[model samples]
Target: STSSPSSSSTSVETPVETLKSYLSELLNNHNAKRALHGVSDLVWDEEVYQYAKSFADAYSCPADGMLSHSDGSYGENLAAGFSSAASVVDAWYEEIQYYNFNNPGFSMATGHFTQLVWASTDKLGCAYKDCNTIYGRYVVCNYSPPGNVIGHFAANV
Candidate 1:
């Protein structure tokens, strides 16, 4: 039998990879499935949808032009990304707070993920009447951005 040193050591997953897997599993859970179905069934108030459309229209990309989807086919992907990122953020909110208080400058470099989530979900919140309450609570209470992180890029511009 041939044994290599590599085989003796256990593989270690990075925090990011572990978080990604956790988020993936969360989306596959029954509650997430139920929420998704509920979302599909809910209707958006036309006026709200129009307002959201206008907001999206007025929004411009930054110098790097990230999250720019000209044809608007990016909505679903954005939603998925936002949901995943939100899940991870939600799970780590306590730890994030500890880090923020204990280590002021500590950043996980998940800024892009947070930005993507905020941008996508903010639009959804505007467009979906049913989502407004939950989204409001999530943004205001559950998933507040860290002090150094910008919640919305367009807002900063």
Candidate 2:
């Protein structure tokens, strides 16, 4: 006896069909300018990064940066590094792991910090002021369609 016709139909998804699967939500376009409320323009400049690294290496918490006995440990060294970095900028934080010895990035550089201040009384956290320095941290932003897209298009036309 012959078996029933084997299933031969196969489903082929098309790009358009796949595209339809993607549901997009229009995130209300809060004016980027408005969203940038109280945004600090601090950026990581090469000079700043270099200076920061040097200062940190030159000075840092001793106990963390170096090994010593209970008397005058690397804590002093760590503090020194932070102090040096802070001298350049208004504020700085020290970051130190094992094997100190003037480790860079142990100190927080205000130059690399950014603060997004909303209209509310609350103050948003400070972003790395120098995140975008040529040799510094990375900075990211959520971009939206240009506010004057139509104007740009019209100009092109």
Candidate 3:
């Protein structure tokens, strides 16, 4: 007639309680606190979330007046489909420059930059000067160019 320990009631942790517990543990640990020194508070702030949402809505892909294809494509080809790969590379360079000027702090990985160069070379059947120029810029930046220029280049290429 006695209830076993397995039958005892248990409390489910709410989201807030779980987050508080995690934060408490993180705060108590010196290493975790040090690692999260600058961003700990922003992690849970509602205002930060709102600001991020606003920025995303404002600047995300499919910018104002841009069309989207039924198949989910952006419907705007960076360089015309029939254009040669060299032309594409040139377009990408100009695009990257524009992005760098517009956005203060963004960078692209060297691996990706090299991949784009190789892809352009493959498509063009020869290496182009744009490849060396873009790659050199990437090297000068230690393989990460400021701004989302690389992203723009990749998309266009």
Q: What is the C-alpha lDDT profile of model 3 across 16-67, one tens digit per residue?
A: 6653453333223312222332212112334322432233233213213232
Q: What is the C-alpha lDDT of each candidate?
A: 0.30, 0.22, 0.26
Q: What value of lDDT does candidate 2 attain over all alpha carbons?
A: 0.22
- lDDT (10s digit) by residue, model 2, range 11-103: 122364432221010011112222433322222234333433344333223233342222211111111122122231222111112212333
Candidate 1 global lDDT: 0.30
Runs of candidate 2 with Cα error greater than 4 angstroms are 1-37, 64-157
Worst 10 residues of 2 by lDDT: 22-31
lDDT of 1 by residue, 1-157 (tens): 8888655432222376663454344333313322432322122234433544444434332223233322332222112123444453344332333333233332444332322233223222121111222221111111112122443333321
> Which prediction has more favorable TM-score, 1 or 3?
1
Better of 2 and 3 by lDDT: 3
- RMSD (Cα, Å) of candidate 3? 21.7
- lDDT score, residue 150, model 1? 43
- Give me the candidate number with maximum TM-score: 1
Best by lDDT: 1
In terms of lDDT, model 3 sits at 0.26
> Candidates' TM-scores?
0.22, 0.20, 0.19
Query: Model 1: runs farther than 4 Å from truth?
Result: 1-40, 65-157
